[model samples]
Target: MAARITARRPSPERRRTARMTSSDWANPYGVRKPYGSNGANHGDGGEKGATLSADHPLVPWKQPDHVHQWVDVDHSREELDRFVRNWPDLGELLDANVGHGRVVIVSGPPGMGKTTLIHRCLYEVQQRVAATGPSAGDPLAVFVPTAGLENDGRRISVDPDGSFAPTRLINARIRSEITKKLLLHEFSESRVRAITAEEDPYQAYGEMSDLLVQRNALLFAVIPHIRWNDAHLRAAFLRTCLSHAHTRIVLFVEVSHGAAETAREVAAALSGSAAVTHLALRELNSEDIWRFSRSARAANGAPNGLVEPDRSSLMAAHDEWKPSDVRELRKVFHSAADALRRAPHPWPIDADALRPHWERRRAGRDALLRHPILPRSGG
Candidate 1:
């Protein structure tokens, strides 16, 4: 007697439901139904079963390891010479103690070339190091620009308008920006994470201080603007660097008329310490202006090679020209040079104005004069 064997099979309704469940799992929000089989319609709609393709590239891909080269500025020979001459003590100080732990502060009026000189120093120092192998523990120069401190503070989101939220904010923005950039560019993620996670901002600062000291790094701060409470900011900076006695920190503050008093006060505080040395920057002379124009023209290339005549020709033609005249010519060349650099079609300045041009082309002259780099006629 054979036992009757029966196997239970899923009902048709059950099979259909299973298939439907699988389909629902594949496209939960009915995106495929309305949008066809194409994987679209995932908009702001909260659909559950959607997934991005596996190979989608993300923003901020690992940047190549880049060594930031110092920026080059073209100052006239005269201006460079004058700066060196005026700040003879600074040159001496740098020469003597740069190997040791000496901090030099170059502060002065805006557009007076504080940034320029610092760049020059960095380039020179690096060049010296490269030419002659560094002595044991010779400090390596590091230039940090303080132009974007507010943005660095994360106070102003950098998404929309790029302006600072408030003008009165302390312009320690440069320090913040430089710190962020240095962290991003120079340090490892784990090291940065460890340093930044410290409770006090000054702790991270102290870490940088120690790191620089260990590496014998010379830090040059290019501060273009300062606020009323800049002393507090500077104190924090000094404390951070001074915590490690071997770290040398140079502060180059570019003083604007509005911020001159504050800059002076900050400089006074920094100067109170023997470790810090302060030097004021002065306006470039005509020769310096000429050299700057020439270098800028050569490096950037002038329009039609006519924006600025050869330096010798310019000097010869304008030998009798007043310093003011040379200044105006340099401005014209700078404007034309900039325009050439930025635009596909270059605007050429009148070659004659490298000497003297026709009065009829006054409009052209006015156009060139309108460049922001050019000083206003009366001023």
Candidate 2:
């Protein structure tokens, strides 16, 4: 009989110091909180986030459990087509923001890596801040996801015990950003609400800006949700930020719906303003068939992802796959891989070996995609 595992309760002493303390070497922040304890973890590289040279905890949902080490820069470039377009390079975005303080709106379809690209860019920019102070050499930059903020501009939260509790994640992020002197906010449209009398994006933007000004920090906000609502002039918010800051402002608006309308709004909003640059992302033009579609018999002879000689057929294929759909495509690929994990050391993941399973997945993948995306205009 197999032994049953049970949840062990922590003793009083253990519970008292349940939290992990951060070393001065690990992170500048004193106490590091793990994921799901109170809120999400901010950019602390765990075993998962360690895959990349820089730590990005905000978008952990997008991380792959096992990316084959064999995939080189060329392979990743070929595989990740979404990041290649609007962002030809993350350095460009960083340079524009750091050098000019420009607001860059990255518009694209859902799952096309808008969030992934933004996070990656911010991570690289932040490394400069981590190494030297924003005042030391380079301007400091910090990445913040605004899903947790309230529109009233309130930064503190009250617990049931009537004690004032601030979001550790936001507090940690703010501490890092203010200390560094750059604030890169990842503001989401869905989660934000109007706490103050002003509407969302405006009210929220005002509050955040006031906080940054109070702290005397430079702002570099990246908002994934820039909805197109022509009914009200949304340009006011962008214009407001631009007017206040002597520096250029960036708005990385990843629009899932109304890309055309959103772009038009941006252009109209910044008609006189030359600082705001809007970049649009489209699908990749490449061969649908992958050379590595030999996952079935190919898995048998390979030593941990290294395929053997000649008996090669990789897993994962798509007839009508789009570049932006890579995230969804990986979900299907991993699901198939998980289903086949126990069968053999290397699962036969070729088209023939996995087609039936994929068909079942397609047939049953009936859930409506919640995020609305505009069609890619052109290459």
Candidate 3:
């Protein structure tokens, strides 16, 4: 997943997320695309250009670090129920990880918010970890995807043009950034090592697994596809059992019709070694689509007046969203948020200011189903 996410998108933050991970978002997917792809800004939930269309957006949106955090409008209690209500409770996951490491397998279809759920839970754990910095004996947590680290061993590189670039992919950058933002601490180098072919991915993995056995580290493994790497994953799971540290492995496997068999095989591998729990992400209903999505709220509070979409209007628009188009929702929100930030227009944007892009988005909605890897259901 890290490799693919990095290659598909050009956003460095997204790429860094693929490399280092560790975002507290319960939605565990990396925002970056794989290397050499132009559409990476859409991966994860970061925004690059302020607009969604080739043309400039209505509200100029710009933010450093590609993070788009739209402040949702004051929602009605009944309408704004958390989309992530069903998974193993965040408190439970944290307690398990902090007390005795746990090996949990979370399975969900692509775009079913698997990444989001993981990220949400991760953020809680991160906050807890940060509140009380870890000592050598305490367990530290790292969020990583099954794709492993994609960057070469070096932390930064010198380009031919003389611009120095980060050697690690966007994943590394994200892990580093999240630590500073949430934990108020720099990401420690000792916590993550650049895996080289010389050292081998599994060798590095093994070393990390050994730490878990020692009770020094906790790993949140994001398995993009259950069917993709059964044998290798099984080996890693077995390693956790050897740890006297109460080490545990948490797995988030993306599901498809054909994935169940592979999941069972992995469960069999764990057998007596680790306790396992299975979780299926909830499919988004219309209500969730509204809550998890964006509105003109953030800009509304600005000195300049803005157009705020009424609930009826917002629900009507959300109704058009295809459930499988979950990833697209992120793109839309990021784009809109960024556009608002950078737009040259006066304070508080109105619907008229947003209609052009909204129209374009709606027109393109049907095309999202053809998106590679994540098509909107019935799109």
Candidate 4:
């Protein structure tokens, strides 16, 4: 008989790591089709694997920087046009070698396209910078989502004095977030690992800043929703980022309109001493949504003979859902199109037809938006 061959099962931690490392798990947002593709996809939840039709008014929905497309900025769309026109000052700030620290607070209601706008602006700046020439000192914008920075769902080491406990924990989380971004930027993996391993997170962060400075690169970190309680931790991180004194770094803090206190705290941390820029995004009304939809339809151009939504049907769905923000509007239209596609005939589909489907998806979608990414602890 052959010697007994036993395959030791992977440790729980290893198994968890394997699961988290999967493409779908890493990017909760599923693989996006090439830009200008008729349909888009959200990750596996709510409307699991639901693909919008090419001719759907909201086919190419708003997305993060990784999947952003220049074509999404339709000049005919009032909101998109105004957002781009009013956004130049900050864009200039990011591209300029100002050699100082600054903070830009972009406040808006939930689902108002704050992240999408910021990503688009940064994407434009990147394009312009490339046209000028490639240099180490070029400004590099890094997006850092802060939802997971809070508690991180990991048991923390108790500290009686409470002096460094929160700082240590939050710093580690922040360091991890930045490390992932740097790796994506093609920074050395071994070097990144070594830097993250530094005992002091602030020191490690400073090393990150120095690395950018050495290459004459500026780091524009876009962190959304800095909780009121975590304001100080963010402030501390900002201080570390500005350590270079000569290396210009920008911190773009995004908060919902309801989080006034959080925004004030983060701004106060700057003490009115550092350069600060503020912009507010208002929720869209039905008219604005209608205008955006019409403009998008024209700009995106549907396939010939493809049943397109008329304003009446689109308005009917809008009235049914009564969407409160850009995000909700996108979902409403996308779901309406999905319903139309599933119909036995190409007859017009309205909100009533999508109501049951939308209702069933509401709870799951709300939960997902609340915690888009709950990063598991550990490497």
Among all candidates shown, the one with the greatest TM-score: 4
Q: Pick the candidate with the highest lDDT.
A: 4
Which lDDT tens digits does candidate 2 get at residues 1-379?
2222122233445433432222211211011122443223323333321112111122322222112211111123432343334332223333424433455555454444455455444444454345544443344344444332111112322223433332332223323333233312433222222212233333444454544333444455554343323314245545544543333224443344333444454446666545555554444333322422322111111222312212222212333332234334444444454454343333334444345455555554534133322212220
Among all windows of 10 consecutive residues in model 1, the one with the lowest summed lDDT is: 57-66
Candidate 4 or 2, higher TM-score: 4
lDDT of 1 by residue, 1-379 (tens): 2222222333555434433322222211011211222222433222344432211111110101001111122232334444444432323333434443445555544334344455454444455544443453445556565553211222321212433223213323333555675564565556555655555544555565566655555555555433213345445544444332233445544433322344456465555565654555444344543453443321111112223324543433333432222223334444444333343332223233323322333345433211122212221
Model 2 scores worst on lDDT over the 10 consecutive residues at 23-32
* Predicted structure 2: lDDT: 0.35
Ranking by lDDT: 4, 1, 3, 2
Better of 1 and 2 by TM-score: 2
* Residue-by-residue lDDT tens digits, candidate 4, 1-379: 1222222333555434433211222111122332333222433122332333321112122333233222232122344454445443433444335545556666565556666555555555455555543443345555444332221222222134422244466556556776788788877788789888999654665576667655555565656553323445556645553442324455655655443444455445555554655555665554654554433321222221113334554455555554556555555545554454444444333444446545666666664243322222330
Q: lDDT, candidate 4, residue 180? A: 84
- Per-residue lDDT of candidate 3, residues 1-379 (tens digit): 1111111122444333333212211111113322223223444333332112221111111111122222122221211133234334334444434544455444443444444444444454455555544432455665654343221211222233433322223223323332232222233335443322213333444444454545544556544332222354434433433231233445443332222444455445555643444444434555554564433222211221222323443444444443443455555544554454444432222223334455567766656432222212221
Give the TM-score of each candidate. 0.46, 0.48, 0.43, 0.57
| lDDT measured at residue 316 in model 4 versus the true structure, 0 to 100 | 51
Model 3 misplaced regions, further than 4 Å: 1-101, 130-136, 146-211, 226-248, 256-274, 293-305, 320-323, 333-379
Query: For model 1, what is the error of residue 154's alpha carbon versus the real structure, in angstroms, after optimal superposition?
Result: 13
Residue 76 miss distance in model 1 (angstroms): 7.9
